[model samples]
Target: MTSANPHRPIRGGAAPAAHATLPARGGVGLKPEHFRHILDTRPDIGFFEVHAENYMVAGGPFHHYLERIRADTPLSIHGVGLSIGGEGPLDEAHLDRLAALLARYRPESFSEHLAWSSHGGAFLNDLLPAPYHAGTLARVCAHIDRVQERLGRRMLLENPATYVEFEASTMAETDFISEVVGRTGCGLLLDVNNAYVACVNHGRDARAYLRALPLTAVGEIHLAGHAHDVDAAGAPLLIDSHGAPVAEAVWDLYAYAITLAGPQPTLIERDNDLPAFPVLAAEARQAEIVMARQAALEAA
Candidate 1:
Protein backbone atom coordinates (compact mmCIF):
# COMPACT_ATOMS: atom_id res chain seq x y z
CA MET A 1 0.00 0.00 0.00
CA THR A 2 1.18 3.51 -0.77
CA SER A 3 1.69 5.62 2.33
CA ALA A 4 -0.44 8.68 2.97
CA ASN A 5 2.67 10.69 3.87
CA PRO A 6 6.05 9.16 3.05
CA HIS A 7 7.60 11.25 5.83
CA ARG A 8 5.29 9.95 8.53
CA PRO A 9 7.35 8.57 11.37
CA ILE A 10 6.96 4.99 12.62
CA ARG A 11 8.47 5.24 16.07
CA GLY A 12 9.31 7.83 18.72
CA GLY A 13 10.33 11.23 17.34
CA ALA A 14 9.55 14.95 17.56
CA ALA A 15 7.58 15.83 20.64
CA PRO A 16 4.14 17.39 20.50
CA ALA A 17 5.67 20.63 21.66
CA ALA A 18 7.95 20.73 18.60
CA HIS A 19 5.17 20.03 16.07
CA ALA A 20 1.74 18.71 16.76
CA THR A 21 0.24 17.07 13.70
CA LEU A 22 -1.68 19.70 11.74
CA PRO A 23 -4.45 18.61 9.38
CA ALA A 24 -3.13 18.24 5.85
CA ARG A 25 -5.94 20.36 4.44
CA GLY A 26 -5.39 24.05 3.62
CA GLY A 27 -5.01 26.98 6.05
CA VAL A 28 -4.46 30.74 5.94
CA GLY A 29 -2.22 33.21 7.71
CA LEU A 30 -4.16 34.85 10.55
CA LYS A 31 -4.36 38.58 10.01
CA PRO A 32 -5.77 41.21 12.38
CA GLU A 33 -7.79 42.59 9.51
CA HIS A 34 -9.85 39.40 9.40
CA PHE A 35 -10.12 38.81 13.11
CA ARG A 36 -13.80 39.66 13.38
CA HIS A 37 -14.80 37.75 10.25
CA ILE A 38 -12.88 34.70 11.41
CA LEU A 39 -14.35 34.84 14.87
CA ASP A 40 -17.88 35.49 13.72
CA THR A 41 -17.88 33.03 10.80
CA ARG A 42 -15.45 30.44 12.11
CA PRO A 43 -14.48 29.23 8.66
CA ASP A 44 -13.65 25.60 8.00
CA ILE A 45 -9.93 26.13 7.75
CA GLY A 46 -7.41 23.39 8.53
CA PHE A 47 -5.51 25.79 10.82
CA PHE A 48 -4.34 29.38 11.26
CA GLU A 49 -0.75 30.68 11.40
CA VAL A 50 0.49 33.87 13.08
CA HIS A 51 3.75 35.75 13.23
CA ALA A 52 5.17 35.02 16.68
CA GLU A 53 6.45 38.55 16.98
CA ASN A 54 2.94 39.94 16.74
CA TYR A 55 1.73 38.15 19.85
CA MET A 56 4.90 38.49 21.91
CA VAL A 57 3.29 41.41 23.70
CA ALA A 58 1.87 40.87 27.17
CA GLY A 59 -1.77 41.45 26.30
CA GLY A 60 -4.32 43.34 24.18
CA PRO A 61 -6.97 42.83 21.44
CA PHE A 62 -4.51 40.64 19.51
CA HIS A 63 -4.35 38.08 22.29
CA HIS A 64 -7.98 38.65 23.11
CA TYR A 65 -9.06 37.62 19.61
CA LEU A 66 -6.29 35.05 19.23
CA GLU A 67 -7.21 33.08 22.31
CA ARG A 68 -10.82 32.90 21.19
CA ILE A 69 -9.91 31.92 17.63
CA ARG A 70 -7.38 29.38 18.82
CA ALA A 71 -10.09 27.68 20.83
CA ASP A 72 -11.96 26.94 17.62
CA THR A 73 -8.94 26.22 15.39
CA PRO A 74 -5.33 25.03 15.40
CA LEU A 75 -2.57 27.62 15.55
CA SER A 76 0.93 27.67 14.11
CA ILE A 77 3.50 30.21 15.33
CA HIS A 78 6.01 31.43 12.77
CA GLY A 79 8.85 33.63 14.01
CA VAL A 80 10.43 36.40 11.94
CA GLY A 81 12.96 37.87 14.40
CA LEU A 82 14.97 35.04 15.88
CA SER A 83 17.80 35.78 13.45
CA ILE A 84 18.90 32.18 13.50
CA GLY A 85 21.21 32.78 10.56
CA GLY A 86 22.89 35.84 12.09
CA GLU A 87 26.61 35.98 12.77
CA GLY A 88 26.08 36.79 16.46
CA PRO A 89 24.91 34.34 19.08
CA LEU A 90 21.23 33.56 19.51
CA ASP A 91 19.26 36.08 21.61
CA GLU A 92 18.67 34.46 24.98
CA ALA A 93 15.99 36.99 25.90
CA HIS A 94 14.10 36.46 22.65
CA LEU A 95 14.32 32.70 23.00
CA ASP A 96 12.99 32.91 26.55
CA ARG A 97 10.03 35.00 25.41
CA LEU A 98 9.45 32.62 22.51
CA ALA A 99 9.53 29.65 24.85
CA ALA A 100 7.03 31.35 27.12
CA LEU A 101 4.78 32.13 24.18
CA LEU A 102 4.94 28.54 22.94
CA ALA A 103 4.13 27.23 26.38
CA ARG A 104 1.21 29.61 26.77
CA TYR A 105 -0.29 28.86 23.37
CA ARG A 106 1.03 25.36 22.71
CA PRO A 107 0.88 25.91 18.98
CA GLU A 108 0.87 22.91 16.70
CA SER A 109 3.92 23.96 14.68
CA PHE A 110 6.66 26.61 14.93
CA SER A 111 8.95 27.83 12.16
CA GLU A 112 11.46 30.57 11.25
CA HIS A 113 13.36 31.70 8.18
CA LEU A 114 16.91 30.65 7.34
CA ALA A 115 17.86 34.27 6.63
CA TRP A 116 19.24 36.68 9.17
CA SER A 117 17.50 39.94 9.97
CA SER A 118 19.87 41.11 12.69
CA HIS A 119 23.51 42.08 12.81
CA GLY A 120 25.92 43.63 15.38
CA GLY A 121 23.27 43.86 18.12
CA ALA A 122 20.70 45.54 15.89
CA PHE A 123 17.56 43.94 14.47
CA LEU A 124 16.70 44.78 10.92
CA ASN A 125 13.17 44.90 9.60
CA ASP A 126 13.81 42.63 6.60
CA LEU A 127 14.74 39.02 6.28
CA LEU A 128 18.26 39.47 4.90
CA PRO A 129 20.16 36.81 2.96
CA ALA A 130 23.23 34.93 4.18
CA PRO A 131 26.16 33.26 2.48
CA TYR A 132 25.95 29.48 2.08
CA HIS A 133 29.58 28.80 2.98
CA ALA A 134 31.23 26.65 5.66
CA GLY A 135 31.69 29.64 7.97
CA THR A 136 28.01 30.58 7.88
CA LEU A 137 27.07 26.92 8.09
CA ALA A 138 28.65 26.41 11.52
CA ARG A 139 27.12 29.59 12.89
CA VAL A 140 23.62 28.68 11.66
CA CYS A 141 23.87 25.16 13.05
CA ALA A 142 24.82 26.40 16.49
CA HIS A 143 21.95 28.87 16.48
CA ILE A 144 19.47 26.14 15.59
CA ASP A 145 20.83 24.04 18.44
CA ARG A 146 20.36 26.90 20.85
CA VAL A 147 16.77 27.45 19.73
CA GLN A 148 15.76 23.81 20.11
CA GLU A 149 17.52 23.38 23.41
CA ARG A 150 16.06 26.51 24.94
CA LEU A 151 12.55 26.15 23.60
CA GLY A 152 12.58 22.41 24.23
CA ARG A 153 10.66 22.03 21.02
CA ARG A 154 11.48 21.07 17.46
CA MET A 155 11.29 23.85 14.83
CA LEU A 156 11.01 24.06 11.08
CA LEU A 157 13.47 26.11 9.02
CA GLU A 158 12.22 27.87 5.89
CA ASN A 159 14.12 28.65 2.67
CA PRO A 160 14.59 32.26 1.67
CA ALA A 161 13.49 34.00 -1.52
CA THR A 162 16.69 35.69 -2.57
CA TYR A 163 17.20 38.57 -5.01
CA VAL A 164 20.95 38.08 -4.93
CA GLU A 165 23.48 35.36 -4.23
CA PHE A 166 26.87 35.66 -2.60
CA GLU A 167 30.02 34.96 -4.58
CA ALA A 168 31.40 33.16 -1.54
CA SER A 169 28.51 30.70 -1.32
CA THR A 170 30.18 27.32 -1.66
CA MET A 171 26.95 25.31 -1.76
CA ALA A 172 23.50 25.54 -3.22
CA GLU A 173 20.55 26.65 -1.07
CA THR A 174 19.23 23.10 -1.10
CA ASP A 175 22.57 21.73 0.10
CA PHE A 176 22.77 24.27 2.88
CA ILE A 177 19.27 23.48 4.17
CA SER A 178 19.85 19.72 3.86
CA GLU A 179 22.99 19.96 5.96
CA VAL A 180 21.11 21.94 8.62
CA VAL A 181 18.41 19.28 8.81
CA GLY A 182 21.02 16.53 9.15
CA ARG A 183 22.89 18.31 11.91
CA THR A 184 19.96 19.73 13.87
CA GLY A 185 17.27 17.06 13.40
CA CYS A 186 14.96 19.98 12.61
CA GLY A 187 12.22 19.92 10.01
CA LEU A 188 11.65 22.16 6.96
CA LEU A 189 8.77 24.43 6.01
CA LEU A 190 8.93 24.39 2.21
CA ASP A 191 7.90 27.78 0.81
CA VAL A 192 6.91 27.24 -2.85
CA ASN A 193 6.61 30.95 -3.60
CA ASN A 194 10.13 31.48 -2.29
CA ALA A 195 11.40 28.67 -4.52
CA TYR A 196 9.79 30.25 -7.56
CA VAL A 197 11.09 33.69 -6.65
CA ALA A 198 14.64 32.49 -6.03
CA CYS A 199 14.69 30.46 -9.24
CA VAL A 200 13.42 33.33 -11.34
CA ASN A 201 15.85 35.74 -9.76
CA HIS A 202 18.89 33.45 -10.07
CA GLY A 203 17.90 31.67 -13.31
CA ARG A 204 17.96 28.37 -11.45
CA ASP A 205 15.56 25.48 -12.12
CA ALA A 206 12.69 25.76 -9.63
CA ARG A 207 11.66 22.17 -10.16
CA ALA A 208 15.19 20.92 -9.60
CA TYR A 209 15.36 22.92 -6.37
CA LEU A 210 12.11 21.38 -5.14
CA ARG A 211 13.19 17.86 -6.06
CA ALA A 212 16.48 18.23 -4.17
CA LEU A 213 14.83 19.00 -0.81
CA PRO A 214 15.00 16.41 1.98
CA LEU A 215 11.33 15.51 1.73
CA THR A 216 11.18 13.49 4.90
CA ALA A 217 12.12 16.50 6.94
CA VAL A 218 9.39 18.78 5.58
CA GLY A 219 6.81 19.49 8.28
CA GLU A 220 4.85 22.20 6.53
CA ILE A 221 4.58 24.24 3.30
CA HIS A 222 3.88 27.95 2.56
CA LEU A 223 2.33 29.47 -0.56
CA ALA A 224 2.18 33.21 -1.26
CA GLY A 225 2.39 35.84 -4.01
CA HIS A 226 5.23 38.00 -5.36
CA ALA A 227 5.50 41.30 -7.20
CA HIS A 228 6.92 41.80 -10.69
CA ASP A 229 10.10 43.86 -10.88
CA VAL A 230 13.26 44.26 -12.95
CA ASP A 231 16.85 43.57 -12.04
CA ALA A 232 19.80 45.83 -12.84
CA ALA A 233 20.25 44.01 -16.16
CA GLY A 234 16.58 44.63 -16.99
CA ALA A 235 15.93 40.94 -16.42
CA PRO A 236 12.67 39.97 -14.72
CA LEU A 237 12.83 39.86 -10.93
CA LEU A 238 10.17 38.69 -8.51
CA ILE A 239 9.71 40.23 -5.08
CA ASP A 240 8.55 37.99 -2.22
CA SER A 241 5.58 40.19 -1.58
CA HIS A 242 2.78 38.23 0.09
CA GLY A 243 0.27 40.95 -0.70
CA ALA A 244 -1.70 39.13 -3.40
CA PRO A 245 -2.96 35.72 -4.36
CA VAL A 246 -0.32 33.15 -5.24
CA ALA A 247 0.77 33.19 -8.87
CA GLU A 248 0.09 30.32 -11.30
CA ALA A 249 3.77 29.27 -11.48
CA VAL A 250 3.88 28.94 -7.70
CA TRP A 251 0.76 26.76 -7.73
CA ASP A 252 2.36 24.53 -10.36
CA LEU A 253 5.47 24.24 -8.22
CA TYR A 254 3.23 23.30 -5.30
CA ALA A 255 1.48 20.62 -7.39
CA TYR A 256 4.79 18.99 -8.27
CA ALA A 257 6.02 19.27 -4.70
CA ILE A 258 3.13 17.33 -3.10
CA THR A 259 3.64 14.60 -5.69
CA LEU A 260 7.16 14.08 -4.38
CA ALA A 261 6.54 14.74 -0.68
CA GLY A 262 2.92 13.66 -0.33
CA PRO A 263 0.16 15.69 1.35
CA GLN A 264 1.60 17.99 4.03
CA PRO A 265 0.23 20.85 6.06
CA THR A 266 0.09 23.87 3.71
CA LEU A 267 -0.74 27.51 4.52
CA ILE A 268 -1.64 30.58 2.47
CA GLU A 269 0.16 33.74 3.65
CA ARG A 270 -0.85 37.34 2.85
CA ASP A 271 0.71 40.14 4.84
CA ASN A 272 0.11 43.23 2.70
CA ASP A 273 -2.89 44.58 0.78
CA LEU A 274 -4.96 42.37 3.01
CA PRO A 275 -8.03 41.04 1.27
CA ALA A 276 -11.29 39.78 2.70
CA PHE A 277 -11.47 36.34 4.29
CA PRO A 278 -13.11 34.59 1.35
CA VAL A 279 -10.42 35.67 -1.07
CA LEU A 280 -7.59 34.10 0.87
CA ALA A 281 -9.78 31.12 1.70
CA ALA A 282 -10.32 30.53 -2.00
CA GLU A 283 -6.58 30.38 -2.63
CA ALA A 284 -6.15 27.99 0.27
CA ARG A 285 -8.92 25.82 -1.18
CA GLN A 286 -6.96 25.61 -4.40
CA ALA A 287 -4.07 24.27 -2.41
CA GLU A 288 -6.35 21.68 -0.85
CA ILE A 289 -7.63 20.61 -4.26
CA VAL A 290 -4.10 20.20 -5.57
CA MET A 291 -3.06 18.13 -2.58
CA ALA A 292 -6.13 15.94 -2.89
CA ARG A 293 -5.43 15.23 -6.54
CA GLN A 294 -1.84 14.28 -5.78
CA ALA A 295 -2.96 12.03 -2.94
CA ALA A 296 -5.28 10.15 -5.31
CA LEU A 297 -2.44 9.67 -7.79
CA GLU A 298 -0.09 8.39 -5.09
CA ALA A 299 -2.74 6.01 -3.77
CA ALA A 300 -3.37 4.64 -7.23
Candidate 2:
Protein backbone atom coordinates (compact mmCIF):
# COMPACT_ATOMS: atom_id res chain seq x y z
CA MET A 1 0.00 0.00 0.00
CA THR A 2 1.22 3.49 -0.82
CA SER A 3 1.75 5.79 2.16
CA ALA A 4 -0.13 9.04 1.90
CA ASN A 5 0.58 12.07 4.01
CA PRO A 6 -1.30 11.64 7.29
CA HIS A 7 -1.46 15.38 7.87
CA ARG A 8 -4.62 17.28 6.91
CA PRO A 9 -4.77 20.91 5.84
CA ILE A 10 -5.06 23.27 8.81
CA ARG A 11 -6.79 26.62 9.07
CA GLY A 12 -4.95 29.73 10.30
CA GLY A 13 -1.33 29.17 11.40
CA ALA A 14 -1.87 25.86 13.25
CA ALA A 15 -0.20 22.67 11.98
CA PRO A 16 -2.29 20.20 10.02
CA ALA A 17 -3.81 17.43 12.18
CA ALA A 18 -4.77 13.88 11.31
CA HIS A 19 -8.25 13.69 12.76
CA ALA A 20 -11.30 11.67 11.63
CA THR A 21 -14.80 12.97 12.20
CA LEU A 22 -17.10 10.72 14.16
CA PRO A 23 -20.81 11.33 14.27
CA ALA A 24 -21.49 14.43 16.36
CA ARG A 25 -23.58 12.32 18.74
CA GLY A 26 -23.00 8.58 19.55
CA GLY A 27 -23.17 4.91 18.42
CA VAL A 28 -23.19 1.30 19.61
CA GLY A 29 -21.01 -1.71 18.97
CA LEU A 30 -22.36 -4.09 16.31
CA LYS A 31 -22.92 -7.57 17.70
CA PRO A 32 -24.02 -10.69 15.88
CA GLU A 33 -27.22 -10.89 17.90
CA HIS A 34 -28.27 -7.33 17.09
CA PHE A 35 -27.49 -7.39 13.36
CA ARG A 36 -31.02 -8.07 12.17
CA HIS A 37 -32.61 -5.56 14.49
CA ILE A 38 -30.05 -2.92 13.47
CA LEU A 39 -30.76 -3.52 9.79
CA ASP A 40 -34.52 -3.59 10.17
CA THR A 41 -35.03 -0.89 12.78
CA ARG A 42 -32.19 1.40 11.70
CA PRO A 43 -31.83 2.90 15.14
CA ASP A 44 -30.78 6.54 15.39
CA ILE A 45 -27.06 5.93 15.76
CA GLY A 46 -24.08 7.83 14.47
CA PHE A 47 -22.00 4.74 13.58
CA PHE A 48 -21.23 1.12 14.44
CA GLU A 49 -17.95 -0.37 15.62
CA VAL A 50 -16.78 -3.97 15.02
CA HIS A 51 -13.81 -6.00 16.13
CA ALA A 52 -11.68 -6.41 13.00
CA GLU A 53 -10.41 -9.80 14.19
CA ASN A 54 -13.96 -11.13 14.39
CA TYR A 55 -14.47 -10.39 10.69
CA MET A 56 -10.97 -11.42 9.61
CA VAL A 57 -12.28 -14.80 8.42
CA ALA A 58 -13.13 -15.39 4.78
CA GLY A 59 -16.81 -16.26 4.48
CA GLY A 60 -19.59 -16.63 6.98
CA PRO A 61 -22.68 -15.06 8.49
CA PHE A 62 -20.62 -12.38 10.23
CA HIS A 63 -19.17 -10.99 7.04
CA HIS A 64 -22.52 -11.13 5.25
CA TYR A 65 -24.32 -9.27 8.01
CA LEU A 66 -21.54 -6.73 8.40
CA GLU A 67 -21.51 -5.99 4.69
CA ARG A 68 -25.24 -5.56 4.70
CA ILE A 69 -25.18 -3.26 7.72
CA ARG A 70 -22.27 -1.24 6.35
CA ALA A 71 -24.59 -0.06 3.57
CA ASP A 72 -26.48 2.19 5.96
CA THR A 73 -24.30 3.05 8.95
CA PRO A 74 -20.78 4.43 9.08
CA LEU A 75 -18.58 1.67 10.53
CA SER A 76 -15.42 1.68 12.63
CA ILE A 77 -12.94 -1.22 12.46
CA HIS A 78 -11.74 -1.74 16.02
CA GLY A 79 -9.01 -4.41 16.28
CA VAL A 80 -8.42 -6.45 19.43
CA GLY A 81 -5.68 -8.76 18.12
CA LEU A 82 -3.23 -6.40 16.46
CA SER A 83 -0.83 -6.56 19.43
CA ILE A 84 0.78 -3.39 18.13
CA GLY A 85 2.65 -2.92 21.39
CA GLY A 86 4.08 -6.42 21.51
CA GLU A 87 7.80 -7.14 21.56
CA GLY A 88 8.08 -8.71 18.11
CA PRO A 89 7.50 -7.05 14.76
CA LEU A 90 3.88 -6.75 13.66
CA ASP A 91 2.26 -9.83 12.16
CA GLU A 92 2.53 -9.40 8.40
CA ALA A 93 -0.23 -11.87 7.59
CA HIS A 94 -2.56 -10.17 10.03
CA LEU A 95 -1.85 -6.77 8.50
CA ASP A 96 -2.57 -8.20 5.03
CA ARG A 97 -5.86 -9.61 6.19
CA LEU A 98 -6.78 -6.30 7.80
CA ALA A 99 -5.85 -4.43 4.63
CA ALA A 100 -7.99 -6.75 2.55
CA LEU A 101 -10.92 -6.21 4.90
CA LEU A 102 -10.41 -2.46 4.77
CA ALA A 103 -10.37 -2.57 0.99
CA ARG A 104 -13.63 -4.42 0.99
CA TYR A 105 -15.49 -2.66 3.82
CA ARG A 106 -13.98 0.82 3.60
CA PRO A 107 -14.98 1.71 7.15
CA GLU A 108 -15.16 5.36 8.23
CA SER A 109 -12.38 4.80 10.78
CA PHE A 110 -10.05 2.14 12.25
CA SER A 111 -8.68 1.73 15.79
CA GLU A 112 -6.76 -0.59 18.14
CA HIS A 113 -5.70 -0.73 21.78
CA LEU A 114 -2.43 0.68 23.04
CA ALA A 115 -1.70 -2.55 24.92
CA TRP A 116 -0.07 -5.77 23.75
CA SER A 117 -1.91 -9.08 23.43
CA SER A 118 0.86 -11.43 22.24
CA HIS A 119 4.19 -12.53 23.66
CA GLY A 120 6.87 -14.70 22.07
CA GLY A 121 4.51 -15.83 19.29
CA ALA A 122 1.70 -16.76 21.68
CA PHE A 123 -1.66 -15.05 21.58
CA LEU A 124 -2.85 -14.14 25.06
CA ASN A 125 -6.36 -13.30 23.87
CA ASP A 126 -6.41 -10.31 26.23
CA LEU A 127 -5.26 -6.72 26.01
CA LEU A 128 -2.16 -6.85 28.21
CA PRO A 129 -0.43 -3.78 29.55
CA ALA A 130 2.81 -2.39 28.14
CA PRO A 131 5.62 -0.36 29.65
CA TYR A 132 5.92 3.34 28.83
CA HIS A 133 9.65 3.45 28.22
CA ALA A 134 11.33 4.99 25.16
CA GLY A 135 12.05 1.57 23.64
CA THR A 136 8.39 0.57 23.88
CA LEU A 137 7.32 3.90 22.44
CA ALA A 138 9.61 3.42 19.43
CA ARG A 139 8.31 -0.10 18.88
CA VAL A 140 4.66 0.99 19.09
CA CYS A 141 5.23 3.91 16.70
CA ALA A 142 6.91 1.59 14.17
CA HIS A 143 4.05 -0.88 14.37
CA ILE A 144 1.43 1.86 14.03
CA ASP A 145 3.29 3.38 11.08
CA ARG A 146 3.39 -0.01 9.39
CA VAL A 147 -0.31 -0.58 10.05
CA GLN A 148 -1.25 2.82 8.62
CA GLU A 149 0.99 2.27 5.60
CA ARG A 150 -0.47 -1.17 4.93
CA LEU A 151 -4.08 -0.06 5.32
CA GLY A 152 -3.60 3.24 3.49
CA ARG A 153 -5.37 5.07 6.33
CA ARG A 154 -4.60 6.65 9.66
CA MET A 155 -5.72 4.60 12.71
CA LEU A 156 -6.78 5.60 16.23
CA LEU A 157 -4.97 4.13 19.22
CA GLU A 158 -7.09 3.49 22.33
CA ASN A 159 -5.89 3.87 25.88
CA PRO A 160 -5.95 0.43 27.50
CA ALA A 161 -7.90 -0.40 30.68
CA THR A 162 -5.09 -1.97 32.61
CA TYR A 163 -5.06 -3.83 35.96
CA VAL A 164 -1.39 -3.70 36.78
CA GLU A 165 1.39 -1.16 36.41
CA PHE A 166 4.81 -2.26 35.21
CA GLU A 167 7.87 -1.29 37.21
CA ALA A 168 9.75 -0.39 34.03
CA SER A 169 7.23 2.34 33.17
CA THR A 170 8.95 5.62 32.59
CA MET A 171 6.09 7.88 31.53
CA ALA A 172 2.50 8.62 32.41
CA GLU A 173 -0.10 6.76 30.30
CA THR A 174 -1.44 9.99 28.84
CA ASP A 175 2.06 11.21 28.01
CA PHE A 176 2.92 7.92 26.36
CA ILE A 177 -0.21 7.95 24.21
CA SER A 178 0.26 11.65 23.39
CA GLU A 179 3.81 10.93 22.26
CA VAL A 180 2.64 8.06 20.07
CA VAL A 181 0.04 10.32 18.46
CA GLY A 182 2.71 12.96 17.92
CA ARG A 183 5.19 10.57 16.33
CA THR A 184 2.88 8.48 14.14
CA GLY A 185 0.22 11.10 13.44
CA CYS A 186 -2.54 8.66 14.49
CA GLY A 187 -5.69 9.87 16.21
CA LEU A 188 -7.03 8.77 19.60
CA LEU A 189 -9.95 6.49 20.40
CA LEU A 190 -10.42 7.93 23.87
CA ASP A 191 -12.02 5.23 26.03
CA VAL A 192 -13.45 7.30 28.86
CA ASN A 193 -14.49 4.21 30.83
CA ASN A 194 -10.95 2.90 30.62
CA ALA A 195 -9.65 6.20 31.90
CA TYR A 196 -11.91 5.92 34.94
CA VAL A 197 -10.92 2.33 35.54
CA ALA A 198 -7.21 3.11 35.28
CA CYS A 199 -7.66 6.02 37.63
CA VAL A 200 -9.26 3.78 40.22
CA ASN A 201 -6.64 1.04 39.91
CA HIS A 202 -3.59 3.28 39.69
CA GLY A 203 -4.70 5.86 42.24
CA ARG A 204 -4.74 8.63 39.64
CA ASP A 205 -7.27 11.37 39.09
CA ALA A 206 -9.79 10.71 36.28
CA ARG A 207 -10.57 14.38 35.68
CA ALA A 208 -6.90 15.27 35.62
CA TYR A 209 -6.22 12.48 33.15
CA LEU A 210 -9.00 13.70 30.91
CA ARG A 211 -7.76 17.28 31.20
CA ALA A 212 -4.27 16.21 30.12
CA LEU A 213 -5.43 14.12 27.13
CA PRO A 214 -4.48 15.29 23.66
CA LEU A 215 -8.02 16.28 22.80
CA THR A 216 -7.25 17.50 19.27
CA ALA A 217 -5.96 14.04 18.42
CA VAL A 218 -9.14 12.31 19.55
CA GLY A 219 -11.33 11.07 16.69
CA GLU A 220 -13.54 8.69 18.63
CA ILE A 221 -14.68 7.82 22.16
CA HIS A 222 -15.47 4.46 23.84
CA LEU A 223 -17.80 3.89 26.80
CA ALA A 224 -17.98 0.36 28.19
CA GLY A 225 -18.93 -1.61 31.30
CA HIS A 226 -16.34 -3.08 33.64
CA ALA A 227 -16.23 -5.60 36.48
CA HIS A 228 -14.73 -5.29 39.91
CA ASP A 229 -12.22 -7.87 41.12
CA VAL A 230 -10.25 -8.43 44.27
CA ASP A 231 -6.56 -9.11 44.02
CA ALA A 232 -4.67 -11.44 46.35
CA ALA A 233 -3.82 -8.46 48.44
CA GLY A 234 -7.56 -7.87 48.93
CA ALA A 235 -7.30 -4.68 46.94
CA PRO A 236 -9.86 -3.68 44.35
CA LEU A 237 -9.12 -4.02 40.61
CA LEU A 238 -11.38 -2.86 37.88
CA ILE A 239 -11.34 -5.02 34.75
CA ASP A 240 -12.55 -3.85 31.34
CA SER A 241 -15.04 -6.69 31.13
CA HIS A 242 -17.51 -4.85 28.86
CA GLY A 243 -20.26 -7.10 30.18
CA ALA A 244 -22.70 -4.70 31.83
CA PRO A 245 -24.31 -1.28 31.67
CA VAL A 246 -22.27 1.86 31.96
CA ALA A 247 -21.85 2.54 35.67
CA GLU A 248 -22.95 5.87 37.13
CA ALA A 249 -19.38 6.85 37.88
CA VAL A 250 -18.32 6.01 34.35
CA TRP A 251 -21.13 8.17 33.03
CA ASP A 252 -19.85 11.04 35.11
CA LEU A 253 -16.44 10.58 33.56
CA TYR A 254 -18.00 10.48 30.11
CA ALA A 255 -19.71 13.77 30.76
CA TYR A 256 -16.43 15.30 31.84
CA ALA A 257 -14.61 14.00 28.76
CA ILE A 258 -17.25 15.25 26.36
CA THR A 259 -17.01 18.65 28.00
CA LEU A 260 -13.34 18.69 27.02
CA ALA A 261 -13.23 16.68 23.76
CA GLY A 262 -16.63 17.76 22.49
CA PRO A 263 -18.99 15.13 21.13
CA GLN A 264 -16.92 12.72 19.07
CA PRO A 265 -18.34 9.50 17.71
CA THR A 266 -18.99 7.83 21.05
CA LEU A 267 -19.70 4.07 21.31
CA ILE A 268 -21.34 1.93 23.99
CA GLU A 269 -19.42 -1.36 24.09
CA ARG A 270 -21.07 -4.40 25.72
CA ASP A 271 -19.54 -7.75 24.84
CA ASN A 272 -20.48 -10.37 27.48
CA ASP A 273 -23.65 -11.47 29.27
CA LEU A 274 -25.19 -9.83 26.32
CA PRO A 275 -28.44 -7.98 26.85
CA ALA A 276 -31.37 -7.49 24.51
CA PHE A 277 -30.99 -4.98 21.68
CA PRO A 278 -33.35 -2.61 23.42
CA VAL A 279 -31.14 -2.62 26.50
CA LEU A 280 -28.05 -1.66 24.56
CA ALA A 281 -30.07 0.70 22.42
CA ALA A 282 -31.31 2.37 25.55
CA GLU A 283 -27.70 2.84 26.62
CA ALA A 284 -26.90 4.45 23.29
CA ARG A 285 -29.91 6.70 23.68
CA GLN A 286 -28.72 7.73 27.09
CA ALA A 287 -25.36 8.60 25.58
CA GLU A 288 -27.11 10.71 22.98
CA ILE A 289 -28.89 12.57 25.74
CA VAL A 290 -25.60 13.19 27.49
CA MET A 291 -24.05 14.46 24.29
CA ALA A 292 -26.95 16.81 23.78
CA ARG A 293 -26.63 18.13 27.30
CA GLN A 294 -22.93 18.63 26.83
CA ALA A 295 -23.48 20.49 23.59
CA ALA A 296 -26.07 22.63 25.31
CA LEU A 297 -23.66 23.40 28.12
CA GLU A 298 -20.93 24.35 25.67
CA ALA A 299 -23.31 26.68 23.86
CA ALA A 300 -24.47 28.27 27.07
On TM-score, the candidate that comes out on top is 1
Q: In candidate 1, where is summed lDDT lowest over 10 consecutive residues?
A: 1-10
lDDT of 1 by residue, 48-129 (tens): 9999999999999999999999997888999999998898888889999899999988889889999999888888879999
lDDT of 1 at 50: 97
TM-scores for every candidate against the unseen true structure: 0.94, 0.93
The lDDT, on a scale of 0 to 1, for candidate 1 is 0.88
lDDT of 2 by residue, 41-139 (tens): 878788888999999888989999999988888889999998998989898998899989888888888999998888888899999888899999989
Best model per lDDT: 1
